[model samples]
Target: MRMTTNANRRVTDEQIERARSIDLVQFLQQYEPPGELKRIGQSWTLKSHDSMRISADGRWNWFSQNKGGGDAIGFLQAVHGMSFQDAVRTLAGEDFKTIPTTQAEHKAKPPERAAFALPPKNNGNRRVFAYLHRSRGIAAEIINHCIKNDLLYEDAQHHNAVFVGKDENHNARYAFLRGTLTASHFRQEATGSDKSYGFFLRGSGKTLFVCEAAIDALSIATLRKFDGLDWKKDNYLALGGVTASESKLPAALERTLNTFSFKRVVLCFDNDAAGQTAARRIFTMLRQQFSENLEVQTCVPKVKDFNDQLCVKLQNGKNSPSRGTRESTLSR
Candidate 1:
């Protein structure tokens, strides 16, 4: 065993700093075993791997597994399954005397992304309409409004409900599918989907409302409508869902903040523990990243989620027990 001393401390600190500073993208190119890697803009997608998407900033997200991230050190542990000590030593450039070089140095070029495609449209929005309106308790007018705007539809094959996400040019960039059958809870992102442009509903006003699911976002709007609130004045965005290891805020949130000059952010996440944790984490990240003057607040539902609250309200009618007043427009 080696003895611990003050001189050893200086060497250990130097190793940590060097490991942390390694460029993740470059590190992958150098040390990663031969495999299929696809470049998506500045990020790289390991096609053969499990949703390993690495951004230029050294942050990574395993989208398929919903786990991710850290500096170059963590990347090694994740991608190569290295231990902390080995990963650190590798990044500190102390090892690799016997490791084979995988590839010659070459600059990567981003691949041209294919246009987003919606799953085949249903004969009519029949299944989706019934599911959202009758089962989900969303108003007919609200359903019709989304249908008319090309934001929601039913898939032709399985009759799943499709929620669309569009870029600034109004070109569809992502599609989220939800099952409509009773007792079904199937959900997935369509092929070629981009999370940066998640399902968004723009309103006439500047305040923004963010939620975890598309249905929850719509439920909040419906609730606003029921109260005769001007739901159309404020924008809404669904983050798709909360993942345990999502490192930063959703790409959708960042995009919306930059796209619109919104003054207030109301986080309407589900009322459960995971939702509460995500809301708090996102709130902290947004606060640090954006202007200090920007207002940020949480508006969790009284029930499991906004949809549940809306359903209860519909069931209770005017005789429903009084829920506490909410400062956000989503308050019942």
Candidate 2:
């Protein structure tokens, strides 16, 4: 085989071929978080980036980003932004050389995940109600509804507003915290929380609205109520956060799809770059996967997010534009 020097490192063609042929899923399982990679049908999807799928044949495709490759070397290059030389060297290491061809052949078990537990509740939710209604402009009824359903509460230790996410059995599986202090911008997920079970409200309607934060979801519900629409008639889900470069279908959104029979999926992400990118990517993935049965679209707020729009509406009175009035919808 021929040899080449890549950035002062000499590599043989046979070694490069070996690196390229390494199993991508096995590589990710070994290097990345094992829990993030989930099985979707016959293919494997990453919890962090659900649009990216690794086939049983060792091929990988990032459907949202419109990028894909045949093997592990290309995966590292595209996803991790690693150079060809570095990707080759990393895969050619002693540990990677003997990667199993299939999941059954891979015998290593993932490390045990920490147990998930909600923070202790405070004496009352006075601070939570005050902060959400006064600062976030969320409606009292909306906050009360969440509290009634045990989805929202005030943590005893820090007085942070805790947004809970539960599984099908109504077991709490995820928690997102937001500081109630005026000067504090603190936000964090509870340790061992699963992103797949994000904060959400299920409605009888067929449309599912997706957002980036718990406050944004509440803001949308508030806006719908302000517009004379029954807020409980439609579903709402928060993804926690998104990045401009992320092409993954969020674990939360994926789980929602599997649980509900939503006919239409409205992407209510932020109006910023990251939000737009995520909305577009998710829109594409849903359309392709669900085909004609599912109507995937984008309904971006005129401002940065739904929370900002809600605040403006409150400041300007009922004369302000309603939820869909100031928003732009993208169907293509």
Candidate 3:
């Protein structure tokens, strides 16, 4: 077998395979910051990019970016944009001893997770209300409901909108922050937040609608209100984002499907290349996962997203496109 040289050392194919087969979750947990990798049921997902997951068997997939690899070397190449030679050299170093070739040996003690907590609440929600209602075109009634239900609030220091997500026990486990300042476009998940429990609104109906962001979910509710329908009739979940892989499902959507008995799931992603592709892929995944037990569909906005559609309606009044024409749903 031909040998490849790195630095002054000869690299064998066996050594390369050993490096490639290093368990990704273990590698990430060892090198990344505490709480950067979170466990969601059977898989681990990156905290900053919830769409990426690493299975226990050492395979990893970044569904959003449509990239994946079978081991740590692939993770480094795909995520850190490291070249193949560098990834192999880094992983095969003497400083990082290789583990035994067993599934049990792949498990490493994860770092202690940071405590999850919501940001301090502002004395008033004036800025969040103004930003959502005035800037994002969300209805006042919808904002009030979110606040009253403890699903949304304003952070004291920055006055950013804090959208909360709760677990089955109804305890807040996740939060997403969005800046209220028009000039700022800051957005991020709160420290130690779990993406599996995303910001969502519970409803009595059996239909669950999924979107890319909390604001988009609210905009959909507002649009329903504009159509003379009850805004809270159906469940709405913000995935925080979407992944393009047809084989993988977002952690939030997976958790929601397991927690609730929904007969129908509607994808309301943004009207863009990434969003549309994700919607189509997720639609296929749902069919394969649930088969005839569930009905999967897509509901795309005529513009960029539900928020943009709402803004157009507010600006054009009756002259805006009809609700039927503004959004289209494809059943599968």
Candidate 4:
């Protein structure tokens, strides 16, 4: 079982079963700890049966166990001393070109640094800002494509987070912090990497554009809000994943609401089957809230969402039958 580092590490599942089939004495004494297995991340101590210990041969050490298991990523962090990016690559056992770390770099553990929480300064975590900002840039084309269709943006109130081209400054505007999903659904998505259902429609205002989920709202605004189209300058809203319902939002957010000339609210949820049902329910509820006829129209994506349409544009030649309501179930 004890193999040299230069020796190829051939580990067959069968070999493991063979070892396991052996008696405790045979395993503890004769079985070697084949090619040096380096510990990753923190030490892992475990319980075993029948005096099962590898023949140390000056190379084996039992890792003292811990009650809590580290994250899989964390485990790699301890073993190879890798940074987050590098650790990702090492575990994958392949070149992750989206990163710069080589195998050696990944194996090296990151140095400890002081952890501190600074208040909201102008330069709050430039690294995080840069990453998210870049995501916005990559997302811009998709945004523009949406605008070209039929959506619109409210200009005046977008000062907090400015818009490009129309506003001149690169800023993020308002933050609509509501979801149709229960607080629990919103919490799960917010904590995870896929923060799609979000809209930061910053602007000064009264009228609003409301949708069922964050993704639909943001896409409607970013892709076409400024398309000089029919976007009625209402503050956009995404009711998380649910159509607007009897959900209560913080009064502070509601107090900030303003619209242009107070146009009727547009209930633009997805055009999916669920969206159709939700839109009908929302329209009935909202019509009662205002004296004006609240126009609750549903906007369905030709493909999935605006992003899917953008990808189709990118993949097929832009001039091909790839653009617009031509083949989508949306135009109807």
Candidate 5:
């Protein structure tokens, strides 16, 4: 049966109902090109020239443009320039030939550039260095090394520890900010931060150490230093926390594997439920994705995380010249 509709033809109640019942996300997944759609939290963001986001409830809004959302039909009308009759017919599985053209249109456009920007920088990372070196038990030399290399800093506005992730071109593509205050849980990604470029400490070793936060990564480096190992010779990466969603590996790890050669991939996430779950998921994923030549292993922190473990070790008069000394004495 051929379904034909003119602009003047009225869509039946059954047609409208059927179109509305179609799952918008599933429909887009089936029809849209890969990487054009991204799920952030409970909402789905359409990666267009103007950044449009659609909620799970079928409402959408374009941030860069002056546009609000509507039903699935409205989505087609707004985004694809489809008329009401065509939108409904498309949703009802009657007009499927245009999907190829729509996908091609999206693909022909230029890729989205990383409009990454860091927050205001202070005169010096005094508070951040103190927080990491004193409170977080990270070595001062490690903090200084990162600061000198433009990989970390303190935001002038809120004294937040800003960990920067750079691209292969040495451009800042991601910034993960955490408050310096000991009691604060304030942390956020800078606007337009790209997760594919994660904050990392480059090393010469074949083994890659992964952590849940920048502080944990630094803590691991500190631990490596105390063990008399050349800390800078080992790769350290913070994943910005592990993802629970059963998708492919996070952009950071995937990007690393593609860009750098590595034999051993270590999962050094926190020793908690979420971290453990993420480690297991990543372990299985890496094993399946790579051949047996790649060694995927999980090395959970002795405590909650590397930072906590470092603090406990330091307090217990371990690997320190003096007992109960909280401040880092490593030459900066």
Candidate 6:
């Protein structure tokens, strides 16, 4: 077993907790992984990764993408000049030698996503994920990995959601606004906020995670790139917005049972007040739906949220090479 002396601990709950409270300082607490990288946000400009700012808000605001230099093996490998495997071992402590890297030791993964159900017309823009990757000045591997596994949302209701199909010019166009299905109205709610409805990524789900916003789900997808995780086999749905609505929560729980043969549901939400409240409510609904078969766990970012984190990480100074961070008049 790898044991660390009191002096070796890199992060502490108190520090992490403090970081979570302020959106400004959230990005700097990312040292959990030795291979961890940082990105800039839209709100921040002109700061380089090396000279990144930690605003009073506790966010790790970054510099321009051009300024955020690439590091080896993440910053860890760069500092240590080791191969990725050795860098991983460096982080693993003594477990480096004994821990099996065998394929057999790895968890048995679900089947790969063979059929990707692109919206007959979907119009969500994802250059944001890529923008975030570049702003943090993350490595090419990190950026490429995220782009490859981006998830498409298939289950959000109308008014708050729009579906897009292609125009004759091959440009993406909005197809229609969705209405509340019979399935939509049949759930529990706390504050009666229909704004927070449970969503499914792809209906025939097997493994699923739930969060509060489409942005949060996308953020999780962005984070998955760094963690060497995949979200396609593992699906994520957003509950629309941050309101204490339980109306759609139970509906999702039941579908998780009947429509999805899913074994797991991870509730990845913001690490703040609203998220905690919503997660608790959703948990109660889930327990009643499956009793034992459904397993519920919560995922929280040490900072603001998946999107908030990414948004901050990908701000490469005032502007990137192309669709860079929008130059705000307030920034000037």
Top candidate when judged by TM-score against the true structure: 3
Best by lDDT: 3
For residues 241-310, write the lDDT of model 4, one tens digit per residue: 4422223321212332322244445556555544555556556655555447444344556664544543
Per-residue C-alpha lDDT of model 6 across residues 131-158, encoded as one tens digit per residue: 3334333334433443333322223222
In model 3, the runs with Cα more than 4 Å from the true position are 1-111, 318-326, 330-332
lDDT by residue (tens digit), candidate 1, 1-332: 01112222233777888788676666666655566556654457776763566655566655444345547666566566666677777777777432233432243333455556789998899999999988898878778888899999999999999999999998888888889986775766776678789899999887788987799889888887776677778788997765323356777888888888887898998776457767887888778777575788889787888998888878877312244233354642
User: Which residue pairs of candidate 1 clash?
Assistant: 205-233
Model 6: CA > 4 A from native: 1-200, 203-205, 245-257, 311-332
Q: What value does the lDDT take at residue 198 in candidate 6?
A: 43
User: What C-alpha lDDT, on a 0 to 100 scale, does residue 81 get in candidate 2?
Assistant: 71
- Candidates 2 and 4 compared: the better one by lDDT is 2
Candidate 1 Cα misplacement greater than 4 A, ranges: 1-115, 243-247, 318-329
After superposing candidate 4 on the true structure, give the runs of residues whose Cα lies further than 4 Å from its correct spot: 1-200, 203-207, 225-234, 243-261, 313-332
Model 4 whole-model lDDT (C-alpha atoms) = 0.33
Q: Candidate 3 on 1-332: residue-level lDDT in tens?
A: 01234444656787697686566666666667888888865557888888676656555656556455456766776677665776787677543555455543545544345688899999999999999988888989899999999999999998999999999988999998888987775776776787789998999988888998899999888777676666677889998766565466888999999999999888998887667877888888899989979988889888888888888878877322254333444212
Clashes of each: 1, 3, 1, 40, 0, 37
Instruction: At residue 286, give the lDDT of candidate 5.
Output: 92
Query: What local lDDT does model 2 show for residue 13?
Result: 90
lDDT of 5 by residue, 1-332 (tens): 12345556667878887887665665676677778787654356776633565544455554333244345766676677777887788887777643354654453343344456689899988899889988888998999999999999999889999999998888898888888899876766676777788998999878888877788889878877776667898898887656533346867999998999988888888776557766887888899888677888888676777788888888876765343233222111
> How far is 239's C-alpha from truth in model 4 (Å)?
2.3
Error of 1 at 7 (Å): 34
Q: If both were scored by lDDT, which would come out higher, candidate 4 or candidate 6?
A: 6
* Stretches of candidate 2 exceeding 4 Å from the true structure: 1-111, 243-247, 319-332
Backbone clash total for model 2 is: 3
Q: Give the better candidate number (3 or 6) by lDDT.
A: 3
lDDT per residue for candidate 2 within 1-332, as digits (tens), equals: 11223545666798797786566667776667658777654456788876675655555656455455556766776677766777787788633345555653463243344677899999999999999999989989999999999999999999999999999999999888889997776766776677789999878888888988899999988888776677888888987665332344677898999988988888888776556866877788787778978988788787778898888878777523343343343211
Task: After the best TM-score superposition of candidate 2, give how far the Cα of residue 21 lies from its true spot, in angstroms.
Answer: 14
